[model samples]
Target chain A: MVRYLSAALLVASLFWLAGCGSSGVSFNGKDITGLMPDLEFSLKGEGGETVTQARYQGEAVVLFFGYTHCPDFCPTTLTALAQALNKLSDQEREQIRVLFVSVDPERDTPELLAKYTAYFSPRVDGLTGDQETLRELTKRYRTTYSYGEPNESGAYLVNHGLAMYGFDRHGKVRLFMRNDQPVDQIAEDLRALVSIQ
Target chain B: MLHTLYGALTPYIFSPITVLLFLLAVTAYLVGWRRLAARGRPPSAWRSLSFFLGVLLCYLVMHTQFDYYSRYMFFVHRGQHLVLHHLGAFLIALANPLPVLAACAGDRHFPRLAAVLRPVRRVLFDPVVATVLFVGLIFFWLSPSIHFDAMLSLRLYELMNWSMLVDGVIFWLVILDPRDPDRAHTSRFGVRFLMLVAALFPQILLGAYITFADAGLYDVYAICGRAFAIDAATDQVLGGLLTWIPPAMMTIVGALVVLRLYLRYDSEKGG
Candidate 1:
């Protein structure tokens, strides 16, 4: 009975230690830490400056692929992320960067992208590139995109991946946030990511 | 956040057929209970309670957030399947409402009601047929293409749910019938034990395949997208694990019960 009690105490202490362990990042999104390969990208930012994974070193980065014309998912996701970022303290918010990569280069120019992202939050940067560059980046990320057939008015829809990835301070893809996650949960995840360093 | 989650998870539409079926179950139970009491042979409280609980579960699955959120999350969808196929079916079978129902219908002349259902039962309630359907429909509905198609169409989704419920009830009703004279004459326990064993492997294989797959199987979740974000791959894996573990345990429990019954019968005969 003493031996059993010792074993139980040992187990309980181990659990307690685990509960108090490093960087208590309870991600609301799927934890893809070390499961996914390092995400690499180079695109033109809203200000026409070159943007790469290295640019946001030492900060938690959020990357999304969407088009400006997307009727629902794109705006909703951006707004939710904005709300989440707003929930953070200014210092914590400074540790996070959000990149909205436009899948529709034909319409979402650098200026347009800048305007669109600015409407959400100043911290959110809009990124766009030529079709070939965008394709290459999306392929590396395992994201899908395609242009729908043009209508009579010559307007077409671009359907792209509705997911976003979160990278920790070390620049490794650590979380895959679904399109349906609530705003506050996203804020919690962002807070955890901010403390990663 | 929790309120928003709950709101997103609540059922948006009522399924007319499911509601109709639930009403029928309640009416049948009430009529059976009353008739049995009038005859001074009231159905056992346990049986009545089990049947009522089964009907309630059936209603809950059809009309609650369980049904609503199934459209988004793979794990929730698997959960819906488990509730319909296992727990609800088991309780309904244990209730064994057929005799009571017949008593209600035929004014205590259950044989007359049984005679009316005889031909239909002989064809549809064959143990072998039930076993095949019980196992086959699980694979059929869960196959990626079919599941994806069902998600896209409300009609197909309803059909899938109804068929699973019906097949589950039929399979359990046949296997768990304590007083099926035909089952007694035949070595039914041995057959049931074999059926239970046979049902385990295909499910395990399917579950493992889904669990370990590199990519998500269903495209509907990918295309339509969820309201809150969960990684499709991770959700698929969790859903697959859900399918794998619980059903296997249930089958094992069922097999153990069959074995115990077989042993008891053998020991009694030896004595």
Candidate 2:
């Protein structure tokens, strides 16, 4: 009777003691690992060159959907991405490419988009397409965007999704990193995604 | 120049009410100690030290960079929570300042004060009451609406922090009284140990929910923009982890201490 009670108590204590220590690799972002559908589409990169998911084979690709004129979200996210990428070694940095897809294709011409993205980091490539093509591409990812009516200056803002998606070397969507994550954490998640075979 | 001044002074900005309240507590403790010495019943060195450390930590958590950063970072906020509740409360309970205060009030006897405080103390220190208030306050503040709203209003934020500190002191005092003269009403060490252990389950459950959550629970942090540029989701995860881990370790240590004390008492009694 005494032995049984002691054993039972010990087991119960263990249950209460359980937690805190993670049993697996803890992710800083939502682990949509292997959950997202294949990212397949061809978009026009700078200089009107066609860019496809296949082009980034054997390297981790990061995609952000926003316009260059976004005063806060786009510039902040791109700056953070630049800092996060800077934390890595030259070799590790080479294995990653950041693509900024401008939702406001009307104003974000190929040249303007290229120059804007290049200002943040050399590894960042600006991707854009015409209205229908951009709409279809965004639709594939279940992303949303809406253009406000032009103001007194005949300029309008495009509101769009603020999430960044990470694809592993095999082109599988692994990270759904949010815009607010700190640079170090994003860097850590990027490192993990890049390490994935 | 104004921006630079504001930036430099932001971290040291302490609320007038908080400063006043803590200063009053220090005055009471000091006056109480002096009275105790005059009566030839000076407090133990350890208890005095423990109480002072607790008060110091309270000031540090509230007035320092910790509080300033907690306004921005989830993990730092969680750290502030831990200090206010577990460590500060534990050390203050070890000090057990009530008797000292009573002594200071009227040279070891404050009949009028006792009349008012006695019943209040009885209800406040009841084991079940303490546990419920402590645990309920934690969950109440952590609730998405309250947590989110608290960030928007300075008064609500102060209320949340103060309540946590008060309830923590109340809860820990019940478990760590050291001399429970009313044996029947007070919780025994074994029972207190069990209660602490039980508290860990819900705490860990909450932490896991936050850590593994698919979406951000506190939208204010995201809306305000993370000052550190920490992704909101990542900040939430790290905060959840901090909430889950340190409290469990503290509780485990507390339980072990209780168990050891229980064993020592039993052996001394030859039971």
lDDT of 1 by residue, A1-197 (tens): 44344434533553332221123467887565643456578899888888888888888899899988889899999999999999999999999999899989889989999889999998899999988898667655545476778899988877677777888888877777878789999998898888776
lDDT computed for candidate 2 = 0.76
**How would you encode candidate 2's per-residue C-alpha lDDT over B202-269 as one tens digit per residue?**
88988888889865787656543343555678898988998888888878867776777677767767
Write down the C-alpha DockQ for each prediction. Answer: 0.03, 0.02
Candidate 1 deviant stretches above 4 angstroms: A1-197, B1-10, B107-116, B180-187, B259-271
- lDDT of each residue in B101-171, candidate 1, tens digit only: 77667655677877887766664466666666677788877877567546644556787788788778877
Q: Rate the local accuracy (lDDT) of all candidates.
A: 0.76, 0.76
Q: Estimate how well candidate 2 is docked, as a DockQ score.
A: 0.02
Candidate maximizing DockQ: 1
Residue B267 miss distance in model 1 (angstroms): 6.1
In angstroms, the error of model 1 at A161 is: 9.4
